[model samples]
Target: MKILISWLGKTDIDHMQVDKLAAIATLATKHTAPFDTVLILANAWEEHWHDYEKWLNKRLAVISRPAEVEVRQQSLSSPIDYVAIAAVMLRNLQALCQGDNQVYINLTSGTPAMTAMSVLIGQGMYQCHFLQAAPDNSVVEVRIPLDFAATYKKAVSTSVRNKVIAGPSLSSEFSRIAAESDAMKAALNKAAKLAATDLPALILGETGTGKELLATAIHAAGNRSAKPLKTINCGALPENLVDSILFGHVKGAFTGANNDHAGLFEQADGGTLFLDEVGELTPAVQVKLLRALQQGEITRVGDSKTRQVDVRVIAATHRQLATMVAEGTFREDLFYRIAVGVIELPPLRHRTADIPDLVKQIMAEINAVFSKQPDYKSKKISSSAIKFIATQPWPGNIRALWNALNRAVLWADNTELTVTDIQNATVDAVKTDESSPVVPEFVAGFDIQQYIDGIKENIVKAALDKTGGNKSKAAKLLGLANHQTLANWMKNLGIAEQ
Candidate 1:
């Protein structure tokens, strides 16, 4: 069940007067001598790619005797596309590997970035054997040593027990949060699984979408719960401050270093470190972070001695990290390292079915606070009030909803919170002070098409509900060409016109 994977480089002679394919062809002989198939990792954009692929398959057919040979192409914009290279290699292994197969990867070809990525992924994840063909036509297995996990070695065959944190990821905190939509539910479930593993997890979402809450729940569900869970806001800290905050500094390390400070890395040693707004980290800090992950240790700001840490990193950000990497603002290597696991939280407006339940929860908590006050009563929302709250486009997600509830509950005259009170509070919430009157800079995951369609549905539904299913008035309120257009929209969107 063993297979061979190698990249097809130019057939031109190297500095050592050796052909690259000579090594690949030589390595394939040993790997395919007892194999089921072969996977040739090639750059399809390169000239004469088909010729190389055909030659390798023909050579393997005679030298090794494999049943099939397939060429996997790389279409990345450049040879330095580490992310794409790793993805392709891992995917090839996933598809070609078997339970008892010995996977051999020829590292002599491909870009240096590709070689590094393939080695990292092969060693860290796939446990594949690395092979290199010598100039003398001799092939030898290439072994990689890992820093984080001492026992991790290329092509190791011994079975070892996994030591992940033992618990269900869905703790009471996450369970209590109402995410009724299927997308949110799926995200939470996957986040929980990722929380248990040592792989770094990235949570992407709009502001107030509860990214930190999810990270906290993940920490609570992991093996390191007993240890301190340290948090740092990457966006808030300046470059120098970030160094001291994350990697600590010895006493008098800087002008203001009055005392020895333990950075977030040392504080969170043997625990989880939540890096909030990770996308805002400067290039220097990103480089340091990457080094720490690669070396499985960190040095203080003033000390050259590296301290070993067994910390799991969980990062959250609202910025588009892929775009940042493309723009050269974020390190591509660091992005791939931290992006091992990703979770995207859906905004509250997309899952409005949970609004009614959230209303109840918020009101109950609000009443508990009011019970201690004199001349004040707890508040309750009517069905109509909940419906209105669900219709409004919540750009700020759950945080916005909570704030609006505070205003509505306080403005209510009696125990029963009515529609007018909610409307009044909504109006008050929309007003801005003189100092900051302009709109927010962040879009917060707002989809223009989705928002427009949702607004249309709300208007159409509200108008029809108000006019008692009067098509003419509903169309007039919606400014549609005619009632026919309204009917068409409802039909296309699968909305019942009744």
Candidate 2:
């Protein structure tokens, strides 16, 4: 798409003061071809900047040069400060250049410093088209056939490019996610590399292994950090409501539809959308998701109009998607598109080396929450407690570990949580997993298959009862991929929900 990016200058709004057409209008009319989108960076402090946006759109329509106008507010210390102006312009330019966009930087708008920086950045980094308004309000190409600006351009471009991905900011973004084990370190290393680009990423790991947390860190460390980071759990969404929630619907499209609704994709434009438990998406939703990722566009459930969105999708799931694809349950094409950059996080059992640090971190968090309460003493775990924690096979991963520690802290009378406290808190979970199965007698007409089915039925019913008939929670308790798997099991076992 041909995109015209320009700073909204004083002349662009004060039409009564200008003798002829505004600089932006002239550039749009006299250009070789009409632009698909006009991206304007306006001053945030200007009270009537939105008025200028409306005026510019109307002016363009009057002249038959209709382009989608997107105004982004930029806060600058000074309009003439070349450094400040270049920083704002470079950041926006970098995001624009990420796509296959034919960028045109207009030098006739804003101050003289703005124009100069635009030319330097455009020539040095992008080599995009540069245009300016002539004396008679005609648009002319501005070309500089000089090599002196090469050094300055190279230095500035490199800084802008490396500042977020390769610099200290990258580390800071992931600082909240603590890891000490080699397996976890490797996973985080892969995540850091993926955060440097705008690729659709897939995070594969067991549940409670912090997939969403890692996804958040990746978004914070990427180009879309300045925009929204919307998140949703696909497994938690009701089957009937999935379409409307992800792609929205027009008013009167459905029985409950009352007004126009913006879905997660539209809400996360120029940002990131983290889809947790993505393997739970139905086949129909998979097709629509693939189209959105492939084309950067989506249509409402019952609307024919298509809307464009620039969303970096980060999907996470504990389910083995490759296995699902082979089983003809998940779409292979969608898998490949979203798995361009995959990070497989090791479960807490495999990362026992990091348990001590995790214990410290989680305990600190617990203390912070109860700090303000009167007579609430800060608690610390004994070394023996940490050792006991590391010895267990945490099937629920980090989340399970945190729950045990939080419980231990709350129940213990002293400030120091001992191994006894930890054991008491985690006893139910460990005992449940370690329970032995009943042995069957080897008698005539014993039908082993029927006996096994009976056992399966009992287990399913027990899990359902334990979770109060919530299929999703019961599935998690039974170690199933999602509620759908639980339902399939119940059907096969000839069991019914209470």
Candidate 3:
């Protein structure tokens, strides 16, 4: 598919924006190859124009093509009118989108002028797709087909319904990694079908939800199964070092570059590269990544010569890329490229019915680990322990279950592990301060306001603690009316802002 990126000149190359671009580029290279193009359109404001060349050059160097940069100079004396800019961009995009299979990346929120242009152009463009950068540096892509826009109002209404009903799915092979519930299994089956194809797959879920595991499973089952599986944790990398690690650097390319080294792309040649936490990439890296994926080649950091490599890509993240795209922290084009096929893994609590199977499998594995010692033979779990595990909400999912089991194993002196042993281990491992000043006990004749305030405070605090202080998440844990109500309660209690 052919891709186009149009943005206002005044956009800043912030860390978050760069990271979003990197994620997009990675996705594009992995899913859609040999047929993609990127177009960058910027207004001619002094600030926007000043760094244009540098930014353009850097971006061009990373992507796999000779970038087509278009600079439109608006009259400085005239007040910036976004509607006019949108018209201009739409006209330009219309010409580029003549092909039947075409996509547009709208990064029009870099400045007030660009934001206005994006909204107008976005609303008017019948056949184009729009992508926005979110505050957390993720991308949100909106695909507006020309035919759909013919009856725009109805199409929008139906789109929401379709998405809600679709939910998300994962590949079937994920079932082997963990015993997932029916809902989760269905999601996995959906993902498996998507993985069989060459589409870029975005694996979304919460932390420890096995996103990487799913990616690895996809690579293992794909046509490129014989190839190596390379993984990179985007969030863990240093911003400055990302380029060299990904695209390689020539000897003396930087201060620490004593010798030339092939980057991860080269190493993953004829295989798959799995990028974890892709939302953490920087814009500078994004530009280069966009080029590489588009062109199917890479140049060492300091080298002018480009080297080609063949590799498939799989990416995973826990954050909402759509939200990041809206806030101008991500690249619109990159988002569209990687989102060809999206799969979301369900959290642990949502699949409570699968707990029994998971517990049995975990116990078996633990037993296998202790197989060597006759005195430390495999132990059997009591019915009460199994029931207790089923009842407690596992916020951390399989990871949390594994940890809890480990703790229980440590505390179990008998051949059979019981509910008391598990409970004791959980209480001992969980952090709680006994030295802190205690709130007065609720008395039968307590003041009504005081009693209500105390209960609210306790409930809110417990939920926050359970979710590690993520307010939106804490609200879900508490089963609050919504995030707003949780926020109001937090404000009333004077708890620290999330």
- Judge candidate 2 against the unseen true structure and give its global Cα lDDT, from 0 to 1: 0.83
Q: In model 3, which runs have C-alpha deviations exceeding 4 angstroms?
A: 1-172, 370-375, 428-498
Q: Which stretches of candidate 2 lie over 4 Å from their true place?
A: 1-170, 372-374, 431-498
Q: What would the TM-score be for candidate 2 when compared with the true structure? A: 0.61
Q: List the residue pairs that clash in candidate 1.
A: none
Model 3 root mean square deviation, Cα atoms: 20.8
Give the Å shift of residue 233 in candidate 1: 1.7
lDDT of 2 by residue, 325-416 (tens): 99999999999999999999999999988898889999999999989889999999999878878877777899999898888988999999
lDDT of each prediction vs. the true structure? 0.75, 0.83, 0.68
* Tens digit per residue, CA lDDT, model 1, 1-498: 777777765541232133245766677665435555667777654555555556656666666465466666655656787655766676677876668887888888767887888788777777788888777778887888664245554223232222233434476757877767787888888977786677899999988888998898888877788988988888888875877878899987889888888888889977999999999998988998899877767778888766666689999999999999999999999999889899999888787877887788888887888788897866788898899888776667778878888888777777887766776676534422223324433578966676556656655666665445878867876678898988998887677968
lDDT of 3 by residue, 67-184 (tens): 4444445333233654445545666666666758566555534456765565555556645666655555455666544443457788867976996699854445565765557777
Model 1 residue 20 lDDT? 41
Off by over 4 Å in 1: 1-169, 369-372, 428-498
TM-score list, all predictions: 0.55, 0.61, 0.53
